[model samples]
Structure formats: structure tokens, C-alpha cells
Target: MAVNQESLLKKYISKDQEKQTGQAPRRGPGGGPGGRNRGMNATGKPKAAKASVKRLFSYIGNDKYKLIIVLICLLASTVSSLGGSYLLRPIVNNLVAPDTSVQEKISGLLSGILLMVAIYVVGVLASYGQSRFMLKISQNALQRIREDLFNKLQRLPVSYFDTNSHGELMSRFTNDVDVIGEMMNTTIVQVFSGVISLIGTLALMLYTNVILALVVIISVPLFAKAGGAIANRSRKLYKSQQAALGGVNGYIEETVTGQKVVKVFNHEDISIEEFQVLSDHLQKSQMNAQFFGGIMGPVMGNMSQISYAVTAMIGGILCVLGKFDIGGLTIFTNYSRQFSRPINEISMQMNVIFSALAGAERVFDVMDQEPEAADGENAVKDGVMDGQVTLSDVTFSYVPGKVILNHISCYAKPGQKIAFVGSTGAGKTTITNLINRFYDIDSGQILIGGRDIRDYSRSFLRQNVAMVLQDTHLFTGTVMENIRYGRMDATDEEVKEAAKLASAHTFIKRLKYGYDTMLEGAGANLSQGQRQLINIARAAVSKAPILILDEATSSVDTRTERHIERGMDRLMKERTTFVIAHRLSTVRNANCIMVLEHGEIIERGTHEELLAMKGRYYNLYTGKAELD
Candidate 1:
């Protein structure tokens, strides 16, 4: 199956922050229906003999008893299969021959034949039941895994996400899990069946003709020797292939996110060319994996043919020596072919089992990752408070050696609107990120309500703080729903009130369906201003005591900015607000203004005081070209 199509086949895959928290499994019909979906890496295949067994039991986890029962049923069916084939000898020799009695002997063998037929029928039913049972087991295992991984994502610090690409994480949820699930539902079942058939065939052959059976077992080592080496080589190859796939996915994610730039700069052709290079690399690895894996069938088939021919010649010689009859030779020949059937199956499936395990390991690697930061035990809900914010001797870095915020200090009393003005990458937004505990400080403490912010649960910290970023993100929902995102339980009237506070209610009502209109993916249908208005309304409804407006009015037209500032005045009046704006004009009325330079607090005071200083802030606000 095309896994990518099914990857987004559900109602709609939420790629952003809509993941449900808690121990409950993710709601889903998951990972699609079958192995037909195509996509892999590694040489030195991890020994699946023991690890897979553990993972299988782990996959079964508490469902071990159920799996044991399934195995018991499989064994019984296997015994029945051997019994049915054994009965064929009597039915062929005694019931069907011209020398046999027309009635008496025929009737006796007929009853045995009927019993054998019944046994085969029951075994067929059991095999089907086992397959369905395993599928359900695999489905639940994958769902639980997806939910756990998502929760881990929530606890991870910003630096963790900063280090990894979104696409790499996505592969863990997509390609990796599917590999494990396919093994559980399909490959494992095949392995079980192949083992039973192989052992039973060898046993029945030995019972019929020992000489022929010994000859067949001789070449078994040859198949094992070749298969084992191919599996080992494939391990490294699969690892390389999966890593290449990650690169392709990362490219797609990065390019799509920057699609506007690509289009404007007419870089589509260049991007495609770059993509082709990665694609060619992936193709080469994939072709190698497929080429080696593909040869297993033909190689095994040839070995099986040689074994069958040898078995026939040996059996003929044994019969000439009066060690076996014609009927026994026929049965021995059938068993010889059966032994080869299982050998061929093992050779082919070994590749799939190894490749799948490698994929599973990559996924588990993500699941095994420790989140950089998480809430402390005994953390409590934040109490409502007058927003008094303070940061002292704060030091932070996205990377260990590169400090983004260095020994910085700031204070904002209750009901004060403190503005941070700087060019991009001057640590304006990083300051706001720290306030929400998106990343913890390397040193010193951030206090809100006169207590260290780290003392509060991360969730509680965020619940008390709100931010309206320059590039506003909106979920796929109605305008009203988007507004209510801050409070899921918010009533329509409450949402309307918040919209009014945002100066967004009037324009929203002008739309055909107004607040009831549903949005498509990422609010793409809405204009930039409309989306920002909704985001502002969301923050308003949140009723958070602390707020950060990062270039909030940058996207609006002059008239809209004037109106939004009026709304902003209503919103920020009673809250401790941090305004990070590139538009110095909009923040001119701030209670205080601070100038930042390279992670340092360069200048500070009220807007008027800074303009009076005629220093860095003065030059920035005046736009009078100043020499560096």
C-alpha cells in the first residue's frame, strides 16, 4: 500500500498541537490496512530470534495468555495437518488400488479419510482465527505507542525540538510503527506456519524413507549460510536507506514551510533539482535493498529444485534396494517437496522480518528519547494573581556553547505594558519563550507573582501566560472555535465578548457565515489579518494574567493597526504585558520601553525618556540613518 496516502487518510491528521494528553491511547483507526503500502536501512540485522521474541511478547504485553492460547491452537492445527497428510498414504494404497476389497477395506479407509478431511477443515478455521487475532493485537500495540510518543513530545523542551526536524519525528509515527505492526499481523504468522510445516514435513519424510530424508537435510546448511549473510548485509543497507528517507522528508518539510519564498524567488526548479539528488540517493539504496531481497526467492527455488531431484534419485535407489515401496516413495517425494516449500518461504521472509525490525528500532529510538525538561512532581495549579514579572541574572542558549540570553534582567509590575524593541534574532522572542518555560534558564530565576516560575507546573505556567506571535497559527475550525481554543469549555457568548475586546467582532459578523464558518487546514482560506484577529481574540478569551504581543500589529494595515491598538489597550490595561514589536510607532504609548542588543539590555525607560536619551533607542525609533 502507499503508506503516504494512508498517512493522511484519516478524518484529518493533526500535525500541530492538538495531541490529547494523558494515558489514554490516541483515538484512531490507525496505520492503514495492509502490507501493500511500500516504503526502509541497516546492515548487521539485529538478531530477531531473541529480540523479536521479546518484542512480540512486549507487543502482546499483558495479553500474553491470549497469545499462548493462539500458539496452542496453531500447534494443534499443525499436528492435524501432519495427520491429514499421513492418512493420504493409507487412502492411496488401501482405498484406491485395484487389489483392494470393493467394500470392506474401502469402507474402513473411507472413515479414516473423512476424519482426516474434518481435521484439515478445523485447522483451516484455526489459522484464519489466529491471523485476525494477531491483527487486533498489533493494532492496539501501535495505538498505545503513538499516544505515549505524543505525550513525550509535550514534555520535551524547546531545545529538543530545535535539534530535530519535524519530519524525522513524523517518520517515527508513520513508517516505523507500520513496520512493527506488519510483522506482528503478517510476518509472525507466516513464520509460525512455515516452522510447523517444515518440521512436520521432515518428520513425515523420515517416517517414509530415512535415506531420502537425510539427503534433503544435507543442503539445508547451504540455504542457511547464504540467507544469514544476506540478512547481515541488509541490516546496514536498511539503516542507510531509512536515513536517506529522513533526509527526503526533511527537505519536503523545510521546502513546504518556506514555499512562499521558493515561489517568489522562482526557486521551484532549483528545489526540485535538489530534491532529485536526494531522491536519486534514496533510489540507489532502495534498489540495492530490493535487488538483494528480491534474489532470495529465485535462489531458494533453485536450491529446492536440486533437493527434490536428488531426493527422487535417492528414493528410486532405495526402492531398488527393497527398503521402500512405490507408495512410500511417492509420499517421501511429496514430503521432500514440502521441506523445500518451507525453506523457500524462510529465505524470502527473513529479509522482510529483518528490514521490519530495523525500522521498528528507529521508531523506538524516538520513543526512548528523554525529554529535556518536564514538570516536577508535586507541582500545583497556579493561583490567580496580579501579574508582577521579574527576571534576574537569566542565562539561556538553544545550544550549549551559544548563549542567546546572557545575564539579562528585567522587571514589569502589575498592569504595566513593557515593550521590547529590537531587530529580528536580537533575542526579543526568546525572552517571551523563556517566560512560558518553553525552555528553562541556564542560571538564575524568572519570577511571576514574586515566586520562581520553575516552581509552577509547565502547563500552569502557560495557562497564566499568553502570547500572540507574529506568524499566528490557527487550527482547522470555525472562527468561533479558533477564538475558543484558549478555553475549550468557553460558551459562545464568552467567545463573542472576547472577539469584541479584540475589535474583531464587527468584521467577523460581516462574513457570510460569520463565526460559524469552518476553516480549512491551517486557516489557509482566511486572510492574514483575519487570522491574526482570531488569534488576538483567542488570547483575550484565555484571560491569562500575563501576555506577550510579539509584533502583533505588524501584519495589519494602518487603519486596522489603529483599531487593534485600541483593542490592545483594553486587553493590556489590567495585565502585565510584554510587547515585542518591530513597529515602534504602535508601542509609543507603552508604560515603559526597553532596548535590547545582542542579548544585552542596552537602554531602558519610558518611550519618551528613551527618545530624550538620543541613544540607540532614539536612532531606532527616529529611523534617522545612524553609522554603525
Candidate 2:
């Protein structure tokens, strides 16, 4: 069942619909800075940023069980941590207090210890359970994200890949995902811990002595001010670090993958020197961020320590003047010291948030990019595409304004064979791409089955068109699965039949595991001829009416090419075929040889007729033939 063109357009956002560069969408800043504002700051209030924190949860998507359970665990963990704080009060008031009966004191002390132990035990268990649960959720989310990203990569125009680095894209999956995972696991927990500790400690401090608590409360603004300022400074540094890391990774991937080329061209020294600049930048960015942001924890701790010392001294003088008890003074000082823990925790965790935020920004950038070839609404509906294809005044470009195919037009009947031959980059592949709407035509109209191709659903157009490209990619799977990829629903017997038609079944049967032999990733274990044979088998299984073979045998040996040529001849008979090749010998028998040069059809005729004219085809054949 083919999806209609209208539906594809409706589902896909066009390349033209992309968001402008620079300004990014706002997600939540949660866990710190806005703990109370766990959800969005939806109201038109002064703290609108706080509202976005709530939106973060919403952005992750709502579910019945997954999120609700996580929320429940967060609440349970916070409660347990807060409950532990109350035990501290009992420990201070009973065991350390004078004028307490032995029996009363022992009971108080034991109860406090038991409460602390209980909360600690439960909290530990809760943390472990929550960690495991969050991992499952993160993994599920990561898996969904990775799948979507890869699918997007597949659908994107080849031009996009040409412009982007494989390493940079791979980082989105590896580094960006790891960043999200670390934040979800560690940063979120620290935020929870800091918040619970802060609120519980503040409440205990006020209860113990309001006057001293006011002093600590005044210090809260100091910590926040410092953290906010440092966060602003560190964000740029952290972002630079990530950017530098990406560059280095990109450089390494390119260098290693093209190492053979580098050695042949004697480019090692220059490449290494270029890589050092990025590596050095990465080191400096990290050092700057950590040195600047890393100083904050101790600075805030010193402020707390100073406040603690001052309070204890003031309390000591007051106690001597009969104003407060020594036990009360101790608790006051202890609470002041305790106050620093959460504040310092917040200050230090800002680095993690910055790093995670940077990664999220990168990940989001990719997620927000526009699809290359989205169809229009109310476009063509899906069918077998049983009509002839007619191109009229069509022009196109992989890059705008530099037309690869200029004012080109052709028409082929349902059963006619169309062979394309020309110099490389003469727009042969680009022309084929237009047939499937891989890149929409810059100008002119293409009719499929008497209807405009744009009107036909993109999937329907693709479903009927099967291409056996020169470079065939095989997924990591068994020999059977590789062939079955042509049509997933194909049975073993059907797959074997296709292999036989492609002349690939003979070698496949001789393999150690036959059809079931598992292949290395990318089918690296197979020989070039074997891989091409398997691809041919795949194309045969598709049984598409409109077959496209783009130099299918150009990469194989002469013997292998002959074998494929025979198989292809058998396969293409009576089917509408488009054969693109640099080898003039293969297409000598084509129904029509459409010669292209600089994107325009220079000549079109049968091989004998073209040879009679002694045109480009004639000279190319005579020029490049074995000449033996």
C-alpha cells in the first residue's frame, strides 16, 4: 500500500519551512535555579524563565505510567531526605543536652538514631531503584531519538551529507546522548538532593533560633548571585569546549577514514598540525571553565564558614549573658555550616547543567532541521504508477542556481528502456533523483503515468522505482536478511529465487552457513563482486516496474561484470529500465542511448545510428575501448 503524496507532505516539514539559524527554542532550566517551579512558568509573571522548567517535562512528552512513576519516586526520595533532617534535631536536643534523665535521654537518643537509620536505608534503596528506572526511561528515549535521527539521515538529500561531516553527525548520537543520560542520572539526583537538603535545613534552622537563621538567609542571596554570575561566564567556555571536541573528533574521523589518501598525498604533517589547534583549544576551554567555575564551591563554603564562626562567637557571648543555651548555640552554628552544603552543591552542579545544556542545544539543532524533499499537500495519491514518464522543460540543481540539468526533457513508455551515458557529473544521477523527487525540480514539470509526479505520493513513486546503485550498502545481518531487505515480507524461497535470477545463489550456497550466514557490519566480510551480486539479488526481489541501474557493474572485475551483464539482460527484458554507466560497451544494445554532456542531452539514438553519425558516443566508445 503506497502512501499518498499529500500525506507525505502533511507529515514532512519542507526544507523551506526551517527555523532561522541562531535563535533556538527555549526548553526548561530545571533542578536548580527553579526547583519550586518544577513545571512551566506559564503565567505572565516576572519570572517567565521559571515557567519553562515545567515545559521541559511537557517537551519530554506525557505518558500514563513512565513519568507518573518517576514523579512518584522523586517525591518519595525528597520526603525521605527531609525526614532524615528531623532526626538531627533529636540528636542535638537529647544526647547533647544537660539536665536529661538517663531513661528519657536513652529513649530519645535511640529513637533519633533509629529514625536516621530508617530514612538512610530507605533513601539508599530508593536511589538505587530510581537510578535503574531512569536508565530504562533514558534508554527508551535515546533509542527513539537515535532511530528518528537515522531515519532523517536516510531521507535527507545526498547534498546534505556532502556538506556535513560524518563525525559531527555521529557526535549527535554518541556525545549528545551521553550528555543527556548523565544529566538525567546524576544532575537530576543532585538537584533533588540539594533542594531537599536546603528546604529541610532552612526549616530546622528557623526552628532552632530565628535570629541566627536570618543571618544564614541573608547569605542565600550571596550564593545565588555568585552562581548566576559564574554560570553566565562558564556557559560560553563550556560551549566552546564542546565545539572544540566536535572539531577534533571530526578531524580524527576524516583523517583516519581517509588515511590511505593522506599517505598517498603525503599530508600527515599538515593534518597533525591542524588537529593540534583544535586539541589545544579543547584543553584551554576545559581548563578555563573548570578553573573559573570550579573556584565557586570553595568561595561559597568560605562565606558559610565565616558566617558560622561569627554566629558561634555571638551566641557564646549571649549564652554567658543568659540569653540562649549552649546546646541551642551549637545547633545554630551546625545549621549555618549545613546551609553551605546545598548552596555549594548548587554552585558546583552548574557546570554539569551547562555541559548538558550545550549538548542539548546541539541535539536540538539537528532535531529541528528541515527535511530535504517533502511533498505538497493534496499532491498525488498512491498507485502502481502504471503510466509513462514525461519530463518537460525541467531544470534542477543540487545547489541552487547552478543547474545540473538545464531545460532537459524526455519521455519513456512503460516498457521502454532508457540508457544514460556521458562524462561524470553530467547530471545522470541527478536526473534519476528527480524521478523519485529526491530533489524537486527547480523548474518544469514531470508527469508520471500522465499525471504530475509531484501529485503522486513520494512513497508510491519510490515503491515502483528500484535502483541498484553502484555503491550498494548492506545492513549488519545474515546473508538471507541482506537479500530480504529488498522486500521484507519476502519468504526464504522467494529470496532464493531472486538470488538465482541475479546469478548470486551459486556462491551463497557455498558459504559456511549458506543463507543464514551472518554478515559483518556493512557486509565488509563479503568480496566486492559478492556484495554487488547480493545487491542485484535485492533489486530482483523488489520486482519494481521502473528499474534504475546506475553503473551497477563498473566497480567489479571483467568476469564479474560479464556475469552481471548477462543477469541484468535477463532481468531488464520487457521491464522499463534506466541504465546509467560509464562503460559504453554495456549499453550498446540499449533500446535508446541518451548521451548527456554538461547536463543537456547531446545525442539520442540507437548505438548503430549514433556510431553512424560518429558523435560523442561514437568517439567515447572508440576512444576508451580496450584497443587491443
Candidate 3:
């Protein structure tokens, strides 16, 4: 019976619920980055099984020559097995012939046995060859799949990363790709060989005896009907099982990452309760899925046995009537058994095939997302940008109909220090984000070096802009290596100089290995202030013409902040700097300070000038009103 894989997938996979609901999917409690929707929606299923299969084949197609050899081996194995069984007819007839001598019968029996062994040996060798060749083909295809997926991720826009959690994207590389690999390694070959064996067995059965062939054929519908019913139920249960599994995994990841927070808040009991709920759901779904999946094998085997018994009884009656010889009856009965074996194998493998297709669909979904817009045709690819920046009536929004920055204008000439101070969500960071074109302005012109920012290629534009954000991140590498990450080709001496400029040199020398000291887990070995110092050193090494410090010293203590501020004074001397700080004292020496409120710059002047005006900036500076 032919399996309608596309139809079966449709019964399980459905559209993602996000399409219907205008809001993003709910994450775990406390807005932690974990949940079933991290990588894929729990309730939703993969769409377009046929398309996923076709695309996966395109990857497999890279090893077409090896695949062809594997196919030939499969054919050889199937043919050999079928041929060996068919030989039973002649061997039995010769041994039982009424006129044959005893010596002749013995000779015939021994030779037939030897020939059967030889054919079986050939079948074994062919099966081995197919397995060996298929291993290489599957590995090669998976390698390409991983490479493509990673490369596509690199080209995806910043907004993509902003919306999707890192855990979800990582799942494509791990769980999703792993399932695809499993399918390619085993299921594809098994299904193909099973189909071939089924066809070969059916043909031999018909050639042996038409009546027996009809008996097996009549039972085909029973097998198909039973398989379809079981598969229908199994697919739904399996879908739920996968979703529950994702939920359990996501919850575990979230809880573990926030163990410190959980302990501090005395929320361990609540966390345990939440985990129990998820684990219980997973257990129930897994039980149902396994029950249905496991039943397919025994059910098909029982039906096959019933078909074999009825065919055997009919064959015996025909043999007694002299309508069929005993030799023919023996071979036909063997073929009858072989026919249902392939059907059973195929039915059992359908679940695996369905899972792999769903995984492929998820992977393809990521690949199909539109990458960042390409560079403009006439965009500047190479030039030295002067430290001059301007924003003319810039309007912007992260979401449509919800403006975050409206008709804002600003300018900073060479070597000028421009500072932005405002309450949170008042577009202080948004202005700095717009300056580097992290998000393009809705309406306005942002010019750097007297040319529109859009006139320069994104890479070239970003090359001149350096930022030290409030959040510091470090990779698993030595202290020196992390510092040099700012400028890939910077020498060791240059790195140390940058560290000194950021006042991180003193701490580095005190570490056990100085600059060579190893850091891991985002520099968990270092204090938060030390991590921020290293981040500042990284930005110092960049030597970019324009610098942005968004709460760059926020994590440090007052003493450490003083040292960083002194180093930052030297670093800011020859570059145009933009600073966003909550502490009003940090912006006291700015060439110009812009006070922003409700995405609009409400005041602009030096510290004394803003104080003289006695408005929002003055109130914030005097502590008469909080900057919340």
C-alpha cells in the first residue's frame, strides 16, 4: 500500500498560531527566554511535507553518484533474496520426483542447498555495500545542511535576532537538524528498500500461482485500512508529545539559567511546581504516542499471519486437487510471507519519516526569512569618515503606528562630546541606535562626513562606529584575545595599550596570568566591574572615529567609575562621542547635552545653561524630580 506522506503530515501539522494572534507568543514566567515557542510553536505543526522532502533531497543530491551506487546495491540485495526463494520450486520438484533415483535425489538436495547459501551470501554482501555507501551520502548531506543554516543566520537582520530567542535559533542546529540526520541515515534507505522488496515479492507471488496472489492482494486493503487508522491517531499523539517535550526542555533551560534569581526570591517551590506540571504533560503525551507507535508492528504482523494461514490452506486444497504442485505451493507460501514483511516495515517507519519532514520544515522556515537589505548600488564601499554626525527631523518606530522617535534633529562636529540624558524609554538609546543605522529612520536624513548615512554601505558605515553598551559579553577565551576581538589584527602591545586606556591594565597585571588569563561563561571568573572594564578596553581598541557609550560605566562602583571616567576622557579627546547616562554628573562636561522626553529633545545646552533654564534637565539635575 502506498503511503500518502503529504496527506498524513497535513493531519498533524498546522499553521503557527502567531499568524492569527497579533502579539508575540508568550514566553515563560518572568519573561524569561524559554518556552515551547522558542524554536517552534508547541501547538503548531510543520506545513508542506512534500516541499520539505524535495528540499532535503536537493541536499542529498550533492552526492548523486554515491546515492546511485547505494540504489544499485539495494536492488541487487532485493533481487538476490527473491531469486533465492524462487529456486525453492525447482529444488523441491527435483527432490520429490516419483521417477528419480535415491542417489540423484541426494545429489539434487545437496547442490540446491549449496546454491541457496551462495545466493543468500550475495544478498548479505549487497546489503552491507548499501549501508556503507549510504552512511557517506547521509553525512555529506548533513554537513551541507549545517553550513547553509549557519551562513543564513549570519545574513539575517538584527531585528530577527531581537524577535527570536537565541535558544530557539540554536535548536535548529541541534534538535531539528539532528532529527533530519536520523531520517537521512536510516528511514530513507529503509523505505526505499522496503518498497522495492514489496514490488519484487508481489511479482514473484503472481508468477508462482495466480490464486495465491489474489489472496494476498485481497488482504492489501485490510493492511492499508488498519495502517491508516493507526497512523491517524499516532500522528496527533506524536505531535502533542513533541510539543510537550519542547515545553519541558524550555522550562528546564530557563530554570537552570535563572537558578540564582530563583534562590534569591525564594521561588524554588513554585519552580518545582511549574516543572512538575510540564513534566506530567510530557509523560502523558509520550505514553500515548509510544502506545500507538508500538502497536503498529504487532497489528501488522497479526494480519500478515492471518493472510498467510488462509493462503496456505487454499494452496493445500489446490495441491490435493492436482491444480497446483507441492513445489509451487511451497514457493508461493514463502513469497506470501515476504510480501507482507515490506508493508509492515514501511508502516513502522512512517512515524520517523513524518518527524524528519517536520524538522526539515522548521529548518527551512529559518532559511526562508529575508536577510538584511542589500547594499545600495552607489553606496560608498571605502573611505575615511570624519567625526561629524547629523540627524535632521528623524522619525522612527520599532513597530508601525507606535513612534518612538519623532521629528528629532541633532548634530555633533569633530571631537565634540554630545550627551543624552532622559528617563528610560525616552529615546536616549534610540538616537544612538539610529546614528549607526541599527534601525533606519522612518523619515529624515542622517549624515556622517557631509553625506547621507544611507549613501555608505552598512559594513563601511559600521566600521567607523564603536559602541560600549551597558551589557558586557565575553567569549570563552583569554583576556587578551577578548580585547583583540575589537580589532582582529591588533598586536599584543596595542591590546595592552587599549587596556591601559580603559584603566583595565592594572587589574590584568594582578590576575594570575595577566593578559593571558582565561575567562569563560561570559567572564564569570571576573567581577562585574572587571567585565565592564574589559568591554571598555575592547571598544578602545576599535579606534573608530565615532564612539558611543550607553551606560558604559553603569556596572562599576564609584571608585572604579572614577578610574574609567579618567581613561574615557583620554579616549574621547580625538573622537566624536555620544553618551547616554542616567547619572546627571556623567554628562556635566559635555559639549552639548540633549534632554529627551517622549521621543523628543525637550532641552539642549551645557550643564549650567540647562540649570539656568530650570526646566526638565534642571529638575533632574537638582534631584527635585526623579529620572525614572
Q: How high is each candidate's TM-score? A: 0.87, 0.82, 0.90
Q: Which lDDT tens digits does candidate 3 get at residues 431-482?
A: 8888887777889999999999998998888888888876789999999999
Candidate 3 regions with alpha-carbon error over 4 angstroms? 1-47, 626-628
RMSD of 1: 7.8
What is candidate 3's local distance difference test score? 0.81
Task: Give the candidate order by descending TM-score.
Answer: 3, 1, 2
Top candidate by lDDT: 3
lDDT at 463, model 1: 89
Report the lDDT tens digits of candidate 2 across residue range 317-375. Answer: 87888787666776667667767877887777766766666555555556555665467
The parts of candidate 1 lying over 4 Å away from their true place are 1-53, 92-109, 205-212, 625-627
In what order do the candidates fall by lDDT, top score first? 3, 1, 2
C-alpha lDDT of candidate 1 relative to the true structure: 0.74
Best by TM-score: 3
Task: Quote the positional error of residue 301 for candidate 1 in Å.
Answer: 2.2
User: What are the per-residue Cα lDDT tens digits for candidate 1 across 381-443?
Assistant: 767855899999899875556687888898998788899997667788889989988777899
Per-residue error for 412 in candidate 3, Å, reads 1.6
In candidate 3 the C-alpha lDDT for residue 57 amounts to 94
The Cα error of candidate 2 at residue 284, in Å, is: 3.0
